[model samples]
Target: MHLDPRLSFLSGPSVMAQLMRDKDWSDSAVGPPQEWPQALRSVVNLLLGSAFPMFVAWGPQLAQLYNDAYLEIMGAKHPGGLGRPLLENWAEIRQDVGPLAEQAMQGHSRYLENLPLRMRRGRGEGEEDTWFTFSYSPVQDESGAVAGMFCACIETTRTVLAERDLRARSEWLQTLFDQAPGFAAVLRGPEHVFAQVNEAYRNLVGGRDLIGRSVADALPEVVNQGFVGWLDAVYRTGEPFIGRAVPAVISRSTGEPPYEAFIDFMYQPLRDAAGRVDGIFVQGHDVTEQHRSREALRQADRQKDEFLATLAHELRNPLAPIRSATYLLRSPAAPAEARNRATEILARQVDHMARLLDDLMDISRITQRRLVLKRERLTVAAAVESALEAGRPLLEAKRHRLQTNVVDPDACLDADPLRLTQVLSNLLNNASKYTDPGGRIAVDARQSGDSIVFTVSDTGIGLSESAIRTMFTMFAQEQTALERSEGGLGIGLALAKGLVELHGGRISASSEGPGLGSRFVVELPAAPAPVAATAASPAAASAAARPRTVLLADDNSDAAEALAELLRLEGHVVHTAAHGLQAAEMAVALRPDVIVLDIGMPGLNGYEVAQRIRAQAWGAKPLLVAATGWGQEGDRQKATAAGFDRHLTKPFDPQRLVDLVGES
Candidate 1:
């Protein structure tokens, strides 16, 4: 192509410049370069020579001209857009760029950074967002009047989008920090000013607004407790501090006294880019409840050790006297009076030991919820009389004066008569043991409104406040002198409390002070509308005695032989078996009228023996009795299920056993 001399400046290695040189500009808004003014020519030459993105919008029609660097921004509009007006090529962005171009033509320079534009730039895609940093300067004519606007620009889409994504990620991380499980906070500077705190931190301190406040001012109660000093240490040394179950007195509410709390926490120093410590990050859990639970477990373990020691001492105390009594009885030269005295001592100590065992068993039953109450309607006076009978020996031995004031002897109660008697007896026995010899003890029972109240007041060694607080706890005992060590196994009152509560009643004790006497009060709800009672039929007369064969089975030889002798004295022929297999064999051979079997036996258990016995044709003729130490309700049910007629615990009354055989 032969280029015209007037358009020689358009001769270059640039694609846009080469395109301009070959075009005919006769119909364009700006005429050919041959007739173009000096200012437009100079600006166009400058636009084509630059390596940076640059463009020119000239004349009233805004004819467009741009360097090769600006072609990328034009996208699909390139080549065809070389000679078009600025609005024609970029009409989608007219609202944004129109004013800038107009200002430039009026002799003012206009600059914009990251100006957003939505225009078609791809070949087949729809209009999309774009960004640019560009400036527009006026190109003056030879007469000094503005004729066009020159724009220098660069696309900033990638940079702007990157910054936007970074901000979004930062917000997501902030949300996660706020929702952390434990309390968290950030403190800034040497003063430890609160910079940020999570939701848990807010709740830990009772929702106080803590931002911008120093640690010492916000938590004044903790200032003297060494927490502030710890924070200062962490910030100064840039070292972390960890604490477990650390104690602090914190005021969780306005105008409230401070309460103690234990926390597991850490203070970590935060560092800046230069590695200099700038702040401290606090994170922790309120572990007060867990700490208390652990301490309670430790205390309970200590109490258990003490209780075991006391039990051993109490059990051994009676052994020496019993052994002495047995030795005295074995001597033939002992006189009648001496023999009777030894026998009496034996009886007394055996009774004392039996009572202790009973209390221990009762405590176990109550704890296991297996103690079923046999509830019945009875009079308060009847219960009081039974209790006094059981407690008379101790009261007489102590020479204590007993005064009974049953103002309402007829006050009725819907309770287990046996358990009620036990409760009253425990209190009476406790009084007799603690009271000095010849002290006065009073028992008062009265009906008060819808309840029955029983008060047992005694002139005794009164209770201390510490003892009063824990006296009803199991295995809890008063700190008494060695002389008062005979105060029983501390389990009596604990058992009493459990029994009373089972009947929907409450028991409490009060004392004026040590040596001023103590009073125990028991209040039970009165029987709701009393149920009418049917007249009791006279007891059935004892059946005429019949000489029937009885089979007795027990692993304990003495127990089996003794029971066999008792049955013989009742005019029944009795045979003894030392184990379950022998008892089963004997039952088959004798075809006895009654069989007393121990539930726990060698060779075969009582349940299996009973099952085998019932399988025989002759088994239905004999009455089966289960006697063993297992006495829970479930045990009775099991015995019955195994074809036994009755269940009896060990140490059952001998008279009852004889009566059972006679009835058979």
Candidate 2:
């Protein structure tokens, strides 16, 4: 019977019992069976011998072989292969084992390498080939003639194939690791030895061979940089470390500047299959360009701040005299023609100086992010009209026609009135300055959605695309040298933008390139308030009447004396104080009607003196008028909180000051 390959061998005792029964049957045969032919008895013996293993017996020659293991390997083939030629039954051994078989037949034992053989068990049974080690030994008959061969073998194909596949994958992985960029390296052990490094890492370390070397030994500089400590920590705890924009200086043997590098890197711990920490894997990229760019930007910002401070100091010095001279020239006793000419020169030059001062102040405030707004509800049309009124002189002098179109006369907005008017006036004045004689400039207002849109359109020299792009930037102007000489410091639009943003509004400019005129639009949110009429009060006319006693304190003697003279001319008794201590003394002795204090004085400033005066019990407290150059919102708050009753900036409107004192 045939057996499957998966079955186990039968026990030796069972096989022996079966063999004994077969021998008894042969011996107890009847007279006719005993008298059977010797050839048939020999056939039976051959079949029994073929049942033994460790013998390559086939084709009627199995009677010569003997071994139980061999019989088990060729189970059920015993009887069929008895006394048969081995080559006919096992065709696979014809090439290699054939020679061995022939050698065995010549009374020689043969040892063969792993060889292939095919075996058949019964008629019509398919054949199978298996790998094996074949050892052939001759089996001889009693006459010493050649009979058959015995063989032994083992299989080694599975182990060989598995080893070959592993080697190919290892080679491919090694190639990929060696070719990677950006300083890739594998470290091993707690010491972080350079177990493997890519070409990038080799180049970074000055072309030195680093494999199999400790990190500190291969690159001693890295140890000084604390990289060794970082690696050790990561390896010990199996944790990762990531650093960005780390600055380093690389030294080279070649005569060159020590190159600076900003590095972004990661140190990751490597682990084995059992999850034990083995090494650290490092990867890094250089960010030198980004570092340089940030440094350049910082330098530029510092330079801009320095320029603004210097400009403010230098520009303010000239402005004070120009303003004082203008005030002196506005007297009524001068000749009509000479007075008119002086007034024109005074207005024009004063406007020019004012624009310069405003630019410097605006730049300082915006850069420091201290610009504050005092918002109030006002009509858009009223704001536009106020701006036009302020710019009327310039428009008339330029002979430009001013047109107004108010589609939404009742559109009110919350904004700083003075600052809002300044924004509109700047736009109108710019329009008038750039437009030719007889050209028309139009101011229009309308409500668009929740916003009130105010547009100032001018038939003026238009802006180039490049100029328009940078027009709202400080010190950016579209005007040529000749046009600039006519007037402008190119900061109006920048100031306008800051002021508009302070009021939660927006300003924009549009033009069809140069020579096609331009339009500036401002959109502000609407509010709920009636537009007040623009009428000057007759009370503003009651000037030139000063208090009975006026205490003037200023560190600048020229300013103090000049102001004292003006106060005296206004019929006030004037007392002067040069500093805070002097002003306090004078306040006690003079008991003046009003104490005009100057801030920014050496030692005790105006605020301190005002506090002292208000706290004193020797005399009646005078009306305190702050008349200093500090005009920021914080300055106003400080003045008020310090017990001053009125606040006025330096080079202020003389008429307004006279009126304030007269009222007091």
Candidate 3:
């Protein structure tokens, strides 16, 4: 019964050759192979009938067989794989693949896709990494008994890894595109139609629904400006374009006006693997606010330069005439009468010019934080009286009637007496300048709790609501169609407000309307100490008492001469000097009660002059008064530290000059 070794090997080959020949015959004409043993013939028939090339192995009752296609699919392991368990021949597939084989042996068919097999082949010296989609199906004998599994498979690892890598790349791109702050968009096709837009791009396009729309349809204006054509050119040529500071205006369906935006952006073409342009990507950032702020700052700088230039030009015009008149007056051969007349004219015009300059300087100091208050204890009544006396000429020139209702005359406050007087004088002067002839101006003060309220009201043209709102702003002016007169520089109220704030007080303006009147109220904290009985009458009592000799020195000869003349008229002997040397000689010879020295002099300055005078071994030392344009706190401290008894700013009131010179 044993077959020869040659015959056994020939048997499998011959059966496979016969089956291939039967492939050309009809299925009905081909009967199953009967001459072979049932076990061997059953295995051969099962292999030939399988949908896929397969191999199977069985024990005792059945025979194992492998098809020609299976021999080719397995390569070198063909005949040797027969008559063996499938897992034993492919041992590396045992872990996850064992159940499939068991299911097939238990009379069921099993299919697995992408089943990884790490098999060691007899190729070269090492194992090869290969993947397979394998299936295991049960085989049956002639009596319909189950046999071992037939294994079928195909390799599929390349496609799986490629799909996974593509998915990861897609997710990363989507995340980055969504989180970008600037606008981003994709335009597809030859027409540059919008394929996708990020959140920022959607907002930039006026928040309209724009996907799938052509660039021309979404923004017709952009098409008119050739922006769409530019994008098309980039897409067609596959060339990148970059633009910076491209000005653009966007109009939305909403009623808002078209807003301006400066755009810096790039257009990059999306190309296929062969480098054919398919789409375009746009990225842009908005720089509107930066542009506007820069423009505004530039305009402000230009205005500031123009204002300073104009101020210098205007000031020099008046100074030229005063200088010419002073040179004539100081000539050796000049007649007394002519000299006096020339001096008077020079003094008047110079005083006017100096007032304007002082106002301008005050405005500058207030704006630059250089102005300071010299605070002291003072009566509100005295401040009001001083302001009235200082502003009497203006009121008289306008023929205005002045009234007073200062009930709390003894109420004293801690304030800068000079600044308080300046504030009141500015208010009075403004009233007189705006009021008509014969109009009434009133100065009133009263006590309100721990504070005193001083009001300067005038029967002048009232302010409109708009005017009142900007009344205290620098450079603001009231508009009057009936009167074409030039108004003040509009810095007085602003300066007053700054000074009041420095003293921890408040000042405000009010009016009924254009024709009624205007009133300014100043409220200040009263002094903590009780009011003195002599406070109400101190100024008057002091003014009537005495006249003293005074020496006035200033680099501005017109100012010094005018002040000396005014002091002489007020019953004080006054000597004038155009320089510090003349005044120093006079001060030592006369031993004057007070020496008013100008801080800014040619040779010897006020500080050095005062020091020299104080160092002299004289019987009665003169009171050193620093008369200078410098009125800051540090300037006052410098004067005091230099042995100056008092500091007086330029363009000071003539009566105040007299009072400081001991005329009251």
Ranking by lDDT: 1, 3, 2
Task: State the lDDT of candidate 1 residue by residue for 1-664, as single tens digits.
Answer: 7778788778788887887877788778888878888888888888889999999988898899899999899888987777689988888888888888888888899788998888788666688877889999998889988888899999999998887788888778778779988889999999999999999888778788799999888888889988899999998888999999999888888997878889999999999999999999999988989999998788778778877887788777777789988899999999989889998887777666766777887898898888888898777798799889988988999999999999988778889988998999888988888899999999999889989999999999989998888789888777762358664677888999999998999999999998888899999888754466876344433453667788899999999998888888878899999999998899889989889999889998899899999999988889899998887778888999999998877656677788787777
TM-score against native, each model: 0.80, 0.53, 0.57
lDDT of 3 at 353: 72
Q: What is the clash count for each candidate, in the order shown?
A: 0, 16, 0
* Model 1 TM-score relative to the real fold: 0.80
Say which prediction, candidate 1 or candidate 3, comes out ahead on lDDT: 1
lDDT of 3 at 497: 85
* C-alpha-based local distance difference test score of model 2: 0.70
Q: Per-residue lDDT for 317-372 in model 2, tens only?
A: 55666665566577767667766666666655655565566566766687677877
Q: What TM-score would candidate 2 get against the native?
A: 0.53
Q: Which model is ahead, 2 or 3, in terms of lDDT?
A: 3
